[model samples]
Structures are given as C-alpha cells and as structure tokens.
Target: MKWLEGFQKLSSVLFILTFQGANCQLAVFPIGPALVNALAGSNVTLAVSFRGAPDPVLTWFKGNLPVGTWTLNSSSPPDIADGSRDVLRIENNGSLTFKGVPKHFSGNYTVELTKSGLGQALVTFTLKIFESIQNVTLSTQPDFAQEGAERFTLQYTMLQGVVEQEIWYFNGGKLKNSTRYLIKGRSLVILEPTRTDKGSYSVLLMNPFSSVTTHRNVTVLYGPDEPIVEALPAQPFYKVGDSLVFSCQAEGFPKPTAEWVFMGQILSDFHQGVLNLTNVQTSQGGVYTCSVLNGLTEEKREKNVTLNVYGM
Candidate 1:
C-alpha cells in the first residue's frame, strides 16, 4: 500500500510538470536592458514574443494603469483600457506600438501573457520619450572682434529636452578645453582672439536619443602686417627689352588693397597688386614703393624695391 501511494505522488508531480511544459513561454527579444528610447512625434514599437500556446491573452500596462490588451488569435483589434486607443496599438505578434508618440507617453510598461490552461508570464520595460532638438541658433556677442585686443564669445541655444553633451568646432575641426578657448555650458569664449581664430564656429548638442548642430561665421580684424614686393626676373641691372613683373602682397582682413608707386607717381592701373612693365628702358629705373592699406583696420604699410636699369 505504501509503494502504491509513493507511485501515485510521483505520477501527480509528473502530470503537473507535463501540463506546465505545454504552456506558452513568454519572452522579449534582444533581452538585455529593457529600455526603449524614442523621439517625440515619431512612430515607435516595443517588441515582444512568445512560444507554445497560440491563443493567449496579452495585457499591457503603463506603469500601474492598464493601457491595452489583445488575444493572440483574435481577429478584432486590441482593446484599449485607457483613452489612448488612437495613439497606442497591440500588434499580432504581441508587441506594443505607438503612433506619433508624445512626451507624456514616457513611462514604465509591462506586458502580461496568460492562456486558458497555461501558466502566466510578464515582462517590463522603461520607455523614454524625448522632444527632438530643433530651432537651434548660434551667434556671437560682438559681430567682429579685434585681433590681440578683444575677447570673443560664441553662444548657442536650442529648444528641446535636456542636452547630454555640448561640443564646439572651429573651421570644421573639434575644439577642446584649453587656455586659449574657454568652453562654457552653452558658450565658447576666445581669450584675446587672433586672426587665426576667425572662421566658421559650430556647436553640436546631443543626448542619448537625439542630436542637433548649428554654426556661425566669426570675423577678426587685424593687419596690414607689412607690405611685401617680389620682382620676377633676377635683379642686378635690366637692359633694353626686359619684361618686368612685380607682385605686391600683404596680410590683412578684408584683403588689403595695393598701390604701386614708381618714383613719386602712383601706377593707377596696377591697383590689383601686379605691376607688369614690357620693354623696360634705362629711364624706367628707381626705388618703387608698394603701399598696402586695410580699409577696415585703416592701417597702411609700405615696402620699397630698387630696380636699376642699365643702357643697352
């Protein structure tokens, strides 16, 4: 009688195991951290899956409140527990989807699965919805700064959620925190900005979910450093039919204009900084002056070149 009783107990345990094994196994795909990131006004889906029982009731809860539910084998649409039926839906594969998600939809979500004669299972996820970065603007306090004299600042602003990172760029290259550059939360300060500091400045703001970028041009006023003159042919003395080409150049913002002066007269036609003399004669020889002027800086500089022409 005792052996028969033991056999009966074992038989009962086996029956329970067999029945549980036949139940549906609920699971979430790519199962690492159950976190979902989505941008506001975007369509997003939170996927889930199950095996075994073909007909199972799935109930989705946002936080503690029920949001939606559906029967896997039912042809009808998912029943919405809340008034968000138009924005939320349950797919045939038991996944929850959101159409044009709003910021208010960010919260914890849980899905429970159950069958008529099977065990129940539930999974949870943390959904984070963020507003897309937009309306970004970049500007500078002073439209233009003076080289070696003024501190320049570039600032940026955007309308969006919290930004996780702010990056600065100068001339398409990444900028780092240094003595010359001061990077604030939303601004960049250039200490004693130089001519080299002038270019396109950009700011990139980003978070774990979204990113945006904006840029602005910066101007720095500096030179007419010093006028420079270069004469093409080898110089010692030029005779009869010598073609002489002189190039005048200077470094300045707004591009300094050059005026070539032979002896004491201004060469009007050589305003482009190039002086071309064809068939140079003995009389066309003296100290030539190249005057460079920066209209913006109002600074002028002069360089002289001596050309000695001998009689043929």
Candidate 2:
C-alpha cells in the first residue's frame, strides 16, 4: 500500500513537469512596437511571433469587435476586409498589414492565437492615426467695411482635424490683441475699423500633425477730405493769351474723383484732377472751383481759387 502511494505521488510530479514544459513551448509574444503612430491614408503593420503550437489560428480584433481570422496552415486568406479602400491582409508570419488606413481605424487592436492543444495567447496594441488638413478657407461677412463702423468679423474654415493654435496676420505682419482688434475663437473682430485697417489678412490653423493657412483681402471705405488746389505759376494774376494750369488733390479710400467748375457752370472741357486753360481771357479769369467726390462715403469737398487776367 505504501509503494502504491509512492507511485501515485511520482505520477503527479511527472504530470506537473509535462504541463510546465508545454506552457514554455507554446509561449507567444508580439514582434513589433506595442504602440503605433500612423498618418491617415498610410499603411501600417502589426506582427506577432510564437514558438511550438499545433499550427496556431490567429484572430485580430479592434477593441471588442472581431476584425479578421487566419489559420497558419490553411490556404485561405483573412476572412474579413474593412472595405474596398481599407485593404487588410494577413502575411505568412501571422502579421496583419493595413493598406491605406483610414482615420476611423485609430483605436486599440488585439490579436489572439489559439492552438488545438495549448492555451490561447493574446497581444494588444494601441494605434493612433492622425488626419492632416486638406484645405483651408477664409471669408468675411460684408467683404467690405465702412470706416468708424461698430465691428467687422473675419471667419475661417478648416477641412480636417481640431485646431490647436490659431494666429492672424495683417499685411504680412502678426496681429496683436488690443482694444481695436479682438480675437475670439476662430474669428477676428475689428472694432471701429479705419482706412488704415484695409489690407490682406490671413489666418493660420495648426494641429499636432499639420498646419494650414487661409487669407482674405479687406478694404475699408472712408470719405474724401478737403481738396487742395495748386496753381502752376503760384501767382494770383495772369496776362491775356497766357497758359494756366491748375491741379487738385484729395485723400480718400476708394480714390476720389475731381471736377472743375468755371464761373457758375461745370466746365465740360475740364476733366480729371487737372484744369488747363490756354489763351486765358477776362471771362475765364473769374473764380475756378475744384470739386472732389467720394462715391462710397457720399462726401464732397471743394476748393476755390481766384485769377485775374490783364492785357499784355
């Protein structure tokens, strides 16, 4: 009976050793990095390695959902493909390759290997797929702003990804936040814009992976200031049959138009900002008025000059 008990104890020790030997031979491990960082539309691979086994059957899962299944000795390919664009296949070494990975494929992935006579083995990996910015556009509500207005806004739109940083530039220089300029989220506000605020404005959006920029041209409409008239000779009196040249100028945003008035009638012969009088007579020597008009601001300014013609 004691010998029987001794034989039973030997059998139990042998069973334990055999079980540990099988566990050591069937150990499985991942071959590559546990974490993968990939860009959208790019390809990536996840690999695993194992020893011994009854020809393991590998299965890939995204989160808790099954992605594909493949048997090592089987002649068939992976049982699943995400879509026509997202091509997925299993290689001979039990590695999964994704061709043209999509943005939505960023998540946790798990691979499970099972053999007929061994315990299952699992390996997990974290995948991060970054989406790049495809396009950017900028626009304004009114396109044109009036000087001394309450406010004007510039808006921006991005094609992909969340914005990590946003910066604005005016006339190729960076814009600062002040009482006149305010930046709120993805919009830029101009408080009481003046003629000096007219220029090219751009907004740049940046993320962890990429950056994009969009630009728009802004115009501020103002008024025509007082007109200045200059005589060619800088003299108040000119002789008969003498040439007289007068120039008028004004300051405005859209560029003001100038007209000349002789006596009480608009001179049809005079155009632009210059008034030329040749062979001046006493009748043409009265008061000459230079009038400037700004169509956008609906403002008009005029300047008058007196000339007396004497007989030569």
Candidate 3:
C-alpha cells in the first residue's frame, strides 16, 4: 500500500447539496486576513466560499493545534458562545464560527478540507481576544493563594447574559494584551501562580444598560503539624496486662501518613504500616518514633516517644 498527495492548487473537493458529481469545486474566500479577534463571550465568524467537490470533509486548526473538524457531527462552540452559534451550514459557505469565548482562546485558525474523491482547500483566519462585557465569570479552579512556593494553574469561565460593554478581568487586573496564551471556548487559564498574584479578582459588567460583577477571594494556606507517635501505656512504665496502642499523625497536602514505630524503627508489619500490640508486658518498652514519608516529594518526618516496662 502506498500513499499519494496529488495537489492541484489545493486538495479539497466540494459536493453541492444537490447532485453535482465531479463538477463540484472548493473555493476559499477571505483567502487571507490579519486575524479574527473577538472579546470573551463573543462568537467569531469566518467568511469563506467553496465550490467544485464531490465530497468535502471540513477540518479546523487553530494556530497549529487542531480545534476540530466539520464532518458528520462537526460542531464546535465558539469562544463562549452558546451551542446555538457553533454549526456551519451551506456546504459551500466560508463562515466558521466560535461560540462564546474566553481570554486564552485567541489565535489563528484555518478551515481545511480533505476531499478523498475530489480535492482540497484551506482558509486561514487569525483570531484575537479581549475581556468580554457579556457575562459574569467565575473562577471554578481551586483557590490556591496559599502554598506560595507551589505553582498552580487556575481556570475561570464566563456565563451568558453579561453586559457586553463592561470590563471583565482576572488576577486582580485585566489580562495583558501581549501575553501569549490559548483560549479554548469561554475558559480563562492562569498558567502558573506566584506570590505577587495572591489576591481577589472579579468580573465587572459595566455598561450604560446595567452593571454587575462576580468576585473570588483567593488565600494561600499551609501547615498542619509533624507526625508524633506515643504509646497509650504510661510513659516510662508499661504493665503486662495493659493495652498497648500506638498513635501516629502528620500534616500536609494529603494529611501526611502516620505509621507505627518501635525501638526507633518503623513497623510496616501490618498490611498498611500499622503495628499494634494487643497487650503490653514488662518485656516491651523502648523509644518509638512515627515516620511520615511522601516518596513523591521526598518529604519525610519523624517524632519519638519512650515508655518503660513493668510487671503485670
């Protein structure tokens, strides 16, 4: 089996809704444009034209990433547009649309055709984005203002029916126009958070019609405590009949692990690092320490306790 790519100007073939057969042709209008910029919560429309193709399958690309294709169920919502704005009709039409949009969704797009039985054609459009005045945005991503050292990616999205002229914002400020980012639908992405970005931000719907806003307060948090282990028996004294219960505890992102310790050694003798002595005897007494460890982060902790042995 061999592959072939025979190009006659382009490779897309178009089929008229009617039976045009091999005479169908594909044409791209607005062959070139600087960009197709839009505000968040806005729909972007592409102007195009097609002709002369037996079967045309639409493929869409943004920047270099494939947004999706317009074949079979080729439906993609624009920026932040409601589902109503995403379908492209007229097998010969050039208008490809992005429904509602988000800040990071701005870029260049190309609507291409893969005509197996005919030819191919590609229409490229550049897209730019701005804060939308249409809807109040909610930052659904976790509030990670805490853990100043850990990097976190936060996400925000806009709802429908916002005042389209109002100023929308994030991270306590408007997104800088020059930042290189990706806007996928009505979603705003914060690549990584830093110390300077710890604060509250809101989406402001400002216009002569009506004004409203949605805000989110972000705060960083830290620390629970080191894990410490101790024997339930009296310190420096344990009787033969006493119940010997060992307790372990720690703190971290996942509430650090607590493990039983005996004679300065961790005891994973139990299925899950748990070790318990049903009854203590004068023969069992020593310095025990709980070892807390998270191998992934290379974080470990240890705290010790001591007990003495006595006859029952």
TM-score of each: 0.49, 0.55, 0.35
**Per-residue CA lDDT of candidate 2, range 82-137, in tens?**
66325677778887788898878888988889887676888898887777766788
| Candidate 1 to native Cα RMSD, angstroms | 9.6
lDDT of 3 by residue, 1-312 (tens): 123443432334432424455456665567446466566666667766666563357666767765555542336422322332343232334356656766566667777776665667887777666653445556645555334343443344445443434343656567532342233444444444443454665655543335667777655433335775555543556667676666776655444556666765657654333457766776667777767765434467877777666774
Model 3 TM-score, all chains together: 0.35
Q: Residue 149 lDDT in model 3? A: 44
Sorted on lDDT, best first, the list reads 1, 2, 3
Better of 2 and 3 by TM-score: 2
Candidate 2's C-alpha runs over 4 A off are 1-132, 310-312
Please give the CA lDDT of all the candidate structures.
0.84, 0.83, 0.56
Model 1 stretches astray by more than 4 angstroms? 1-133, 144-149, 159-165, 171-174, 198-200, 206-210, 217-225, 239-243, 251-253, 278-284, 310-312
Which wins on lDDT, candidate 1 or candidate 3? Answer: 1
- Clash number by candidate, in order: 0, 0, 40
